[model samples]
Target: MNALILVADDEADMEPLFRQQFRRDIKAGRFDLVFTTSARQALRIIGDAGQHDILLLLSDINMPEMSGLDLLARAKAARPNLPIIMVTAYGDADTRRRALAGGADGLLPKPIDFPALRVEINRCLAQWGAGP
Candidate 1:
């Protein structure tokens, strides 16, 4: 099945970068990525899209409106089973601890290593007994 990953960040450049990085997987129908620039938008999408289709959620800890940590709380409240990973450039022990406490499935620091992201995605899918 195709995994639909929703990534919420304020970075406008991320879409093209992610597309380029995951082109092979996207073409193979192994994964599909949806991007939202704000946590609020992401939350709305998550509410509307349902957790079954959205295999994973990747969100930046910093954003204009709602923070990723807040999104984590909202998403987890809506769907506790959903896996949501928090990403940020300001990743530190305190931030990591807060994210974990807020129910984030994983915490990834930026500049995101695409290869590591791939591994983490696969591991997350395996954990949920899904694929790609």
Candidate 2:
């Protein structure tokens, strides 16, 4: 089965960028990416059992209503084993520390380095004994 990645970001353009970047993997049935504009929606998806076979979560820190850090904490609480990576343009030292403290698996700054992200994704998936 394909490994699913749930992404929470307010930026509408991110959807296309992710889909384009992972087109090859998507076509190969290795990975699937799902995008949501808010933490609420992401939390809903996470809370709903068997809604999606999510292997990882990629979230933007500076989202509306709730921050990614908040989501990371809640998501971790809900699914302690799920890997979460925080993606933000404001990746300050404090933010990194807090993310790690809150149980985030990784963090990426914008504009994201897709190559590095791919490496991290593979590492996370391998650690979880899931997809490539």
Candidate 3:
């Protein structure tokens, strides 16, 4: 089964990095990626991607248009059971607290641990009853 993942981050470098990191999964059609730069775009994708087999929503806490924490709340309101994860360059306690409070399933600090992210994605998929 294909697992679609929606990612929201302002960094222009993330697309290449993610495409490189999950090259196999993406090429084999096991994972499909949709990249966006802002929270607004991410929310629109969330609303539209619901019909697909969306596995997770990954967003950066710090963004230009809107914060990922706010996106988390809006996404949750759109899809209560959606498993959303927050990533940020800042690993501060307050940011984490806000993310959790806003209904994020996981909080990851940047530079992202790719290995750990893979594990977390699978774990999130399993929790949502979707095999990784």
**What tens-digit string does per-residue lDDT give for candidate 2 at 45-70?**
99985767788899999998999989
- Measured by C-alpha RMSD in angstroms, how accurate is candidate 2? 1.3
Each prediction's whole-model lDDT (CA)? 0.88, 0.90, 0.86
User: In model 2, what is the error at residue 59, expressed in angstroms?
Assistant: 0.5
Model 1 scores a TM of 0.91
The C-alpha stretches of model 3 lying farther than 4 A from their native spots are 127-130
Per-residue lDDT of model 1, residues 4-114, tens digit only: 889999999999999999898889877789999999999888898544378789999999879999999999998788898899998899999999999998888998888
Best-to-worst TM-score order = 2, 1, 3
Count of backbone clashes, every candidate in sequence: 0, 0, 0
Regions more than 4 Å wrong, model 1: 50-52, 127-132
The estimated TM-scores of all candidates read: 0.91, 0.94, 0.91
Best by the TM-score measure: 2
What's the lDDT for residue 5 in model 2? 89
Which has the better TM-score: candidate 2, or candidate 3?
Answer: 2
Error of 3 at 30 (Å): 1.5
Please state every model's RMSD to the true fold in angstroms.
Answer: 1.8, 1.3, 1.6
1-132, model 3: which lDDT tens digit per residue? 567788999987999999999998788776788899999988887788546667889999889978888899999998898888899999889988889988998899998999989998778768766667
lDDT-best of 1 and 2? 2
